[model samples]
Target: MRQTIRNVSPMSNEGRNAYVIEHLTDALLTLLRDHSINDVSISELCECAGVGRASFYRNFESKEDIVRLYINHLFCEWADAYEQGDDKPLSALIQSIFAHFERHRDFYGLLNERRLIYLLKDVIIGICGPKPEQSKDDAYAKAFVAYTLYGWVEVWFQRGMKESSEEMAGLFKMQGL
Candidate 1:
């Protein structure tokens, strides 16, 4: 049976790529679940994965590398969802992202706050792109949407995912972007 992403298209070759990434993700999650990101070592990761440092490096530069790639790959998936007729804007994407995070909660729960912040910003900018407000240095208006999405999404996660996806979709829709 073909796999689906939130009742969307069946899985593809991209699924194989995601499978590899998920393994790397799983290894990292095991480390974080054991302790925290700070306590984990590259050597330990290699040992746990039973893959050489070279094998790890072949797939990723560092643990964080895989995390970023994972996020980017999800974005590509989100973008593809649009191609598949799910054009609901940032909120739908955010809901899917929440599901993604929930799936890898251990890894992120232990991530360096700075790295998480950067990752969030990277994703926000990737989704929002260069706005006219930013181009014109509109300050609050320029950054409002991204920052709001960034802050509140973190808040949503930290608050134990109290909000439903529809609630989040409402939040994004309220932004009127």
Candidate 2:
């Protein structure tokens, strides 16, 4: 049976596109539970999502693109929550990062289990990586921070995330980072 699509108003193009995106994302993730991304086809994904092929192409270039989009969406959500919090210290930021991952353990765990966590690296870098216009030193600093944070995340996932967010933040604080 096709999964039920939600939250789209019948007449709005934006709503319809959102519906397509949501369904296709769910479809791809569901499919991934049983098949590798390479083994999943566009036709199969479209069928599973209950959307036409044209609908799929209109919203995403490929299955990986859908996953990337979803990852970005999740980060945007975390950023919103972070911005709302008053404490903006480095340790707090680090703790929030770990907390966000802990909150989304199932999705992140799936990525880890399926070896798709590499897809998260670019998204993390894009969100915090250096901009092209920055000076060499500034660019290097940003790159260092971004890659270091990604390293923490990767290692945490690989280790089955035994540490709590507060504990990880404490480790970072102890390191004088």
Candidate 3:
């Protein structure tokens, strides 16, 4: 399945904030598949997203902001699903994630190629609302879980996402992490 950001015409009916975020995120992903993020300029991104320079600036401070926001958007969707009672066995969350990644495979592939997946580890963990114990050990444990899950997903995408979601979940179960 091909997943794309909604175009401007349909996005006009969506909120302005959502419109800007979707367009800018999609435009960045589209460009990243062919060009390095450093090689992309605000003008180029604005043009690709079909928004004026002022509009882009009004929404985002820099190109990096777009990447961060895009990652946050994905995590937020997962959080929403969990809130809506999708959470059961952890495998269910893993399955939903695999499905989500499949939908945005191209963008995830570009992020993987650019070595930017690490930047999202904290964001993903934060959105999941892991228990907030303030102990040093607790912090380390959270970091370990975040990095392990994020790293696994990054490697999976880097490897072309060949495994089925159930297969991936089974591998995790075998590890007992």
The candidate that achieves the highest lDDT relative to the unseen native structure = 2
Name model 1 segments beyond 4 Å from true.
1-22, 86-118, 131-142, 172-177
For model 2, how does the per-residue alpha-carbon lDDT over 44-139 read when each residue is reduced to its tens digit? 998899888998888888888998898889999999988996857778888988999999998898888888888889977886689999999988
CA RMSD of all predictions: 9.1, 3.7, 6.4
Error of 2 at 35 (Å): 1.7
In model 3, the clashing pairs are none
Worst 10 residues of 2 by lDDT: 1-10
Using TM-score as the measure, which candidate wins?
Answer: 2
lDDT (C-alpha) at residue 38 in model 2: 89
The count of residue-pair clashes in candidate 2 stands at 0
Alpha carbon RMSD to native, model 3: 6.4
What TM-score do all the candidates reach, one by one? 0.65, 0.88, 0.74
By summed lDDT, the worst window of 10 consecutive residues in model 3 runs over 1-10
By lDDT, the better pick of 2 and 3 is: 2
Stretches off by above 4 angstroms in model 3 are 1-18, 128-140
**What's the CA RMSD of model 1 in angstroms?**
9.1
lDDT of 3: 0.75
